[model samples]
Target: MFSRRTVLTGMAAGLFAPYFHDVYAQSSALPARLVLVLECNGVYPRALLSTGTRAALGGRANTSDRLFWDAYKDTPLVREGDNLASAISLGPLAESAGKIDLVNRSAVLLGLSNLIAGGGHSSGTGGLSCAVNGAGATVDAVIAPRLRRGAPFDVLRLGTSSARVSIVYETCALGPRKPAGIIVNPSLAFDSTFGSLLGGSTNGRDRKMLFDFALADSRKALAEFKGNSNERLKLERYVSSLESLRTREDQLTGMADRVRPYLPVAPKDNPLLTGAGSPPDSLKWFEAQFQIATAALLGGLTNTVVLATGTSGFDVAYGPDVSDVARHNLQHGLDAGQNWEKVAEVTRRHVQLVANLARTLAATPEVGASGSMLDHTAIIFMSDNGEQHHSTSREWPKLVVGGNALGLKTDGRTVVYPKYDAPRNRQVSNLFNTLGHAFGDADFNTFGQEGSTRIAPGPLSELYG
Candidate 1:
């Protein structure tokens, strides 16, 4: 008889493996994979929208989720027609952002609103799930379960080691009122997934074998079911899942080996005890989270990931590069007498991290598949509130990267839905449903705030390929 811990050890190692690996099989036909990146205190709409957007819209003022221009392919993600990739402020990845944007599979969702969010810090689950206190599962949770047979962990919530963020930063809600737990520290997260075992074992190889054997038992169980012809049909998915798990274990093992050098080493003492200083290790813990996220996606450990980049709990004085003040202050434009450029710098830093994530996935060669890992991923980065430090729920423009996967059409276009006052105005719900469509869920036709007369129920067909 296997102990509960032992069973769990096997389940964790293999549950998601089947679903993630099969759905994420390297193909343009695609399966379901989503990475949702949410930030607080909205970014400016002007900065997010390109100069070409107006002309593409034909200078039309009122339209909602309406198709404006169809590139059918990606172009430079720079503002206006100019291809100044270097000026995009992706930090170390600035060089690739310009060139990649041209061929990158992506899109932009403009004019999204969360009237239900009630503005302010309520942006928490409000912005993510489009319902207060996560009254509905966020898009990530809703779609994650659709991947193949569902990943071991349906949704993996991750938060940066930065200081505390407002309620606006709640990254994921598994179901109605079910906010997902976040693993704040990357080192702890790594151990939880790959370190700690049931028998207080710390050796990575031993743990891997133990889990692998447990998975072998699961496969045997499926085989027992298969022996009876009557049960074979019902157990087909079971057999596929177990087989996928066995195959995915190798992927996970390879990923672990590849990411070992980039892992963050923990400290002997809690550095929060200090009165003044950085985290005491300048190895970039934020970067570590992205590295883990990449491996998780690449290895099929999870199909959905929600990352809240910087919180107020970890105070980072970015120094002369951004500011000597806390991120919260910079977010609110309170530090240094509200230096807007400083705020932009902080926002850019977040973008840079996101850019790095895209680049990392792009670099990884997908096993038994074509293109890179990114070709089979869809990453959405958006703000909890509208375009301002404080929001009015008017305009929420999100940057999208990764395409060809998830059945996302308009992969290379900027779509501005009708404004708030327009007759055919679309709400944030439509965009969320659009994601649902990408996940291949016929049931997720419409999600969020159903009873209201103003609510529109449907996916953005214009964006759904």
Candidate 2:
């Protein structure tokens, strides 16, 4: 019988050998670790910021509502509780946020507005992915190629539902368009992607054999072009694509060597939903996807990823008490007293997901890098709109964490952009462009429609060191 290692080696060499040439020659100096966390219905600005006077809470000054007037003061020790006595008063999300290196390193993009023209929530969601005025490319697409020049999984666009899946569009050479690489139920994809990583199971061993066979074929094909530059490039990429796979295998090996062996529980027997149906066990599915994404990032499997927890038009039931209110419905009453409570709860759940992801990254140490895996990673967390009713983008909660290890800043207090005058609104594209530049896109100055009055030139200078 062929040894397991031999089989896996043979499969990777064979299957991945063909595509290595082109990918290796064209690579960029972007972050090898990146993640994008997007939420639906936006966040309530009032809750995220303090306004009234109550006395400075925590370590930082300006913890009262009066701090809202400054827009530049930072909350030192905002925590979650009934009384807003902490530095970064995050309300329900206090627990998770506290676990990470909490900093008001975020900045408000005042005067920024979404170019939502048609199609209610669905259309707006599409616009968020691409196009601030008309159909255009999104920030995720712009940075994906730069980060994963030699990797197989350049960008993993994942979502909880069908609508969420379409949030990241790809602008290819053909034209400005959307790419078809969405993993709607990423947990199932995770199982299939790293099947061999869960060794010991009969099914896993069989999958490993198949992968080995493919790798052997790829290796054979690569040998045919030994000295050719193009072929050598292809070989290099094939190796890079296997990074995540190799990491999984190493993890399994270590697990096997442990005194007490442990294995992931097999999935339940219920059929998960595909498109338009119930919520489809989002909590469980998302947690699994998070694990897979974290593994991929830690193993250098892929450099860029966009994970949409849910879509903008989602109306699934979160729980019995939460009601089956559509995301759009929650935003319409954001200004109302009672509506803020419901919105706060939904937003808190979303925040919890992000916090969980951050903590996971922080826990894992990098191979050749100092600090935890999260230290070298930059996570961009934001929503399509600030509220559901209007497309206004002012006071939008845009948080950037962990890039500080990558030379970005987030330790100081929150900084608000200069207010715009009159009816002219800043376009969300400006914010998008700023993100692109942050990831090392030198010529990435402008995005979206020309003269659309949506995208401004403000670079969000305060966000950087």
TM-score of each model, in listed order: 0.67, 0.64
- Residues 315-350 of candidate 2 have per-residue lDDT tens digits of 434543543565455556555555557656665565
What would the C-alpha RMSD of candidate 2 be, to one decimal place?
Answer: 9.7
Specify the highest-TM-score model's number. 1
Candidate 1, poorest ten consecutive residues by summed lDDT: 10-19
RMSD of each: 10.5, 9.7
- What number of clashing residue pairs does each candidate have, in the order they appear? 17, 32
TM-score of structure candidate 1: 0.67
Worst 10 residues of 2 by lDDT: 12-21
